[model samples]
Target: MSVIAVNDGTFVSELEGKGVTLVEFGAVWCPPCKVLLPILETLSEEYAEGLRVLKVDCDESPVTASRYGIMSMPTVIVFKNGEPLEKLVGLRPKSAYTNVLGKINAEAARL
Candidate 1:
């Protein structure tokens, strides 16, 4: 699946009933956020079956951002069953993300 744009209104529901979700809290004006977009898009497609990737503009979705305690731009939070599982701040290597997803998948399988 392609990257999904999420707002305050759709945040909660989007996370609900999902297996695993990676939410990027960022703003368009932020350079690092811009740099991270394409990486997330590619991951979204590569992990299509096991993960769901969503983006939330911090400037446009303040409520969702605050709820997630996003003090910095480009904070990526991974969620499972609507609960946050892991959080990564700033720009990270693609392998870093895949590593987290791998752990989540393993945990899910064990459960």
Candidate 2:
């Protein structure tokens, strides 16, 4: 599925269900945020069965950004069961993302 663009109004509801949700907090003008988009898209496709990837434009969603304490561009947070599990700041390798997902998947399997 395509990455859903989330705003302050939709942020909580977007994260309030079953499955794993990956939310990327970013701004339109941030270069690293631009760089991370495709990487997130690819991961979203790969984990489509169990993952939901969403994006929150910090410039447009200040309330959501502040709620999450997002102090930098391209901050990726992994949420499971409506709670954050892992956070990554700046640009990172695909493996960095996969590693976090792997752990979440494992935990999910145990439940």
Candidate 3:
């Protein structure tokens, strides 16, 4: 699947279902956020079966950003069943994000 752009109005609904969601809260002005976009796009397609990728521009969606206590751009949050499970602030290696997904996959397997 492709990364979906979300905002304050659509954020809750987009995350309101079963499965895993990775949401990146960022802004077009942030250099690192720009750097991370394609990485997320790649992951979205690779994990298309079970993961959904979303992007929220902080500048355009302050309500969503503030609700999550996002102090910086590129705050990536992993959610399961509409609840936040983990958050990574700033730019991180793709492996760091993959490790998170691996853990989630493990949880699903155990269930």
Candidate 4:
């Protein structure tokens, strides 16, 4: 499935009820953002049942970026229980995301 496109209006509401959400704020022109695409896609597929991955195009939706205070491209925010738990900036290894997911899952299991 394609990454869900989120914007200023829908981002908060959509993520509020969802148990966990991973949001990527990027633009098509950003090289680092492009590089992170595959990683997000792979993780999205692997954690389809538990995690929700969404993308916001900075160029297309500046409001979303501003709302999140995203000053750079490819700002990844991990939200758990309607609040941001972790954030990653720039190009990072897939492990960065997997590790976060693991933490979320582990904590969720204890709940």
What's the TM-score of each model vs. the native? 0.96, 0.96, 0.97, 0.90
lDDT of 2: 0.91
lDDT tens readout by residue for model 4, 35-108: 99888988889887678888999888888788779998899999987788898988899998999889888988
Predict model 3's lDDT versus the native: 0.94
Our model 1 lands, by Cα RMSD against the true structure, at 0.8
Cα displacement (angstroms), candidate 2, residue 16, comes to 0.2
Regions more than 4 Å wrong, model 3: none
In angstroms, how far off is 27's CA in candidate 3? 0.2
lDDT of each: 0.91, 0.91, 0.94, 0.87
Q: Give me the overall lDDT of model 4.
A: 0.87
lDDT tens digits, residues 15-108, model 3?
Answer: 9985899999999999999999999999998898799999999999999999999998889999998999999999999999999999988998
Tens-place lDDT digits, model 2, residues 1-111: 878998999898888975799999998899998889999999989988689999999999999999999999899999987999899988999999999999988887898
lDDT of 3 at 25: 96
Question: How many clashes in candidate 4?
Answer: 0
Compared with the true structure, what per-residue lDDT tens digits does model 1 show for residues 39-106? 99999999877889999998999999998799988899999989999999998888899999999999
Sequence-dependent TM-score of model 3: 0.97
At residue 77, give the lDDT of candidate 1: 99
State which candidate has the highest lDDT: 3
**Clash number for every model?**
0, 0, 0, 0
